[model samples]
Target: MVDVEFRVVSDRRDGLLLALGQTVIAAGFTLLRQRMVNSEEGVVLTMVVRGPENGLLLLEERLGTHHLVNSFEASPVDASVANAVSAPAAAAPAPAPAARSNGGAPKPASDDAATAMDTRRVEALLPQLARDYPNIFIQLLALEHDLPPAQREATLRYVGQRVGTWVYKRDFSLGGHLALADAVRHIALPAMRQLVQAELQDDTLRIKNSPFCHRGEHGSSCHFLRGMLGGLLGGPHGTEGLRVVESHCRNTGAEACCFEFHA
Candidate 1:
């Protein structure tokens, strides 16, 4: 078992809660219970979690995102008395700088130029591209066309899963299972700029009208969206049982991109 206490500086509880969930996922634990105790200075969040191997290390990595947390503490609980606070405190060591894979040798100028362009265009232009340009779609196409077929598909799916984790971590405090489903529905259309029709039955989720399907082609697409759904539902939140499948796609002459998510 693991117990964590976070001292939040601000009452903006939403972000802090989300950050806590992110940290919990990073620590490779399932949050069993959480309590918020109001104090004179600020709110103190106490979390009880199912422990993982190297849980302290995971928590330390995730704490970097807890900007609102003024102070934090964690301790592994003894199995005999899981609630007892007598266990030694886990103090994370200071992180060291990252080293190069090539023994610090300089990379090619052409590689550096490509990397610079990707950073400037992809990172800097993301928000504006989503609003004004079809940059998201363009980038998706570039990913597909710029690499070999297998590598391109694998890259898209991997990116999708990572983005899914990001989305789930940011909005995880929305409450129980039904509420989470509703949260996903509410965020879809506005965020993706496509009409999203969602249906939940048992553990299966069917989603149609994805933004990636707004264009036309000739085969199965929307792999990134599939990855996003997989990551959001399964990643970080202990819902890895969920799986995503794009059964229909506009690229395949379907009316829209239809994704079926099930265990």
Candidate 2:
């Protein structure tokens, strides 16, 4: 048997270890040691196991495609590494450095500033958002006012992606993978209804009275919505190369905001 170590990053801790344990057993591995810790990246789970050398590929594939796994790294275990497993878990990996723009300057704050919403903060607010769904616009408007005009949409989009991914993990990560249209209908539409009036027809999602986009205005206010849809539908288990495009916006003379999902 060969020993391998896996480090997994996920948005939530609940059921993650259990699910992973099952996957490991099914992949013909014997769990040797594991560790989990809270971090800015969400939950980091490190596991060491022993299995047939040939099973490494299958194990990696399963972990990579797991809906709960945002990212993971696997490496063969060695003597020094195995010794370290007895020590306290190391800190979660630091987040990747922000991408630099032209001239080696950092991107705009809105593009790469600290995430607008982290997993913990979103988890804390979800119940309240569900309870007072209609009043969420007030909070959203407040969030808009706090951001610079140049940064508003980008910041909102970042928050949208975070929240969207969280919602998918919490609600839709179970059962099995879903196709683009089914996910849009079964996952996106219902999740959106909590915050906006949305209907799915064909491959387009129509939104009425978006809190962010006011009638008669001529600007894009659906950046957050676009980001949310992207997060919900663009993961490994979801549809790959899925794009959410806002074809029409109420602010731009449309009766509603029409977001087209192209897979």
Candidate 3:
């Protein structure tokens, strides 16, 4: 059995984690063991990955592609953990028609169709958002709460985030619902949740020992465990604001999604 390992220290307590599961998803890798430790220097992350070498390379590319690695001081992964993380999640790719938690499934998008619109969905969503409202989408991403399951794909399919209007060329990926939710919900999220909650519960531990909770944190740090939503929007950083607005735009485009905000 091929295995790979990485012991990484980040100056930021939780760098790359926001995008870690997402990275695993985009590269189609399976997460084995993931632990984050808070030390004097910063956050220390250890991950076990199992997948094809090509797939692993793909993930490395995304680490750079998504700015996840730059979020911290990432070192080259040891071969064992690298091999482990590179192995595919399933012997076969999850057959299309990915299921929704509600026992529903989306019609399999055709192979010819773009997976997440080759990043164009983000390309379109954020610039238009800048055109309409600046600092909103990024602020929304800062919220721990994600777009509700019902609206996640649709909303993500229409939006993006970038540094500036003309600089909209750099956009956060507005895709990966099927992969992110599934990967974390089953494999990664459980442990990540435990680690964060343990830190929060230990009142003796302050600041340095705490995981950074997004915006106005509720009872839970992990969104899926107890959910990350906060009281129908209208809180600091508007943690639940995006989800509240996204509800009306089910399967709609950005213009339609945005108009609902004003209308």
Q: Compose the digit string of candidate 1's lDDT tens values, residues 1-263.
A: 45444333445564455456545654556453355667876877766555555676767656644677766666655544544332222431211111224665222113433333333223222332223222234334444444444444445655555444544445553645533355345443233433245554433345554545443334786767776676656533535466667777777777656666555
The runs of at least 3 residues in candidate 2 whose Cα sits more than 4 Å from the true structure, single-residue gaps closed, are: 1-135, 215-217
* Top candidate by lDDT: 2
Each candidate structure's count of clashing pairs: 0, 0, 18
Q: Write the per-residue lDDT of candidate 2 for residues 9-123, one digit (tens) a residue.
A: 9998866776786677668776656778999988999988777899899999999999999999988898466656523333422222224667663233343434443334333
TM-score-wise, the better of 1 and 2 is 2
The list of candidate 1 runs beyond 4 A from truth reads: 1-135, 173-218
lDDT tens digits, residues 1-263, model 3?
23445455565644355456545544555454456778776677666655576666566666545543434333445666564443333432221122233535332223322243333333323333333232232223422133333443333322221122122112212323223223223322232233333212211111121222333433222222111211111122222233322221212221111111110
In Å, residue 1's CA in model 1 sits off its true spot by 57
Return the top candidate by TM-score. 2
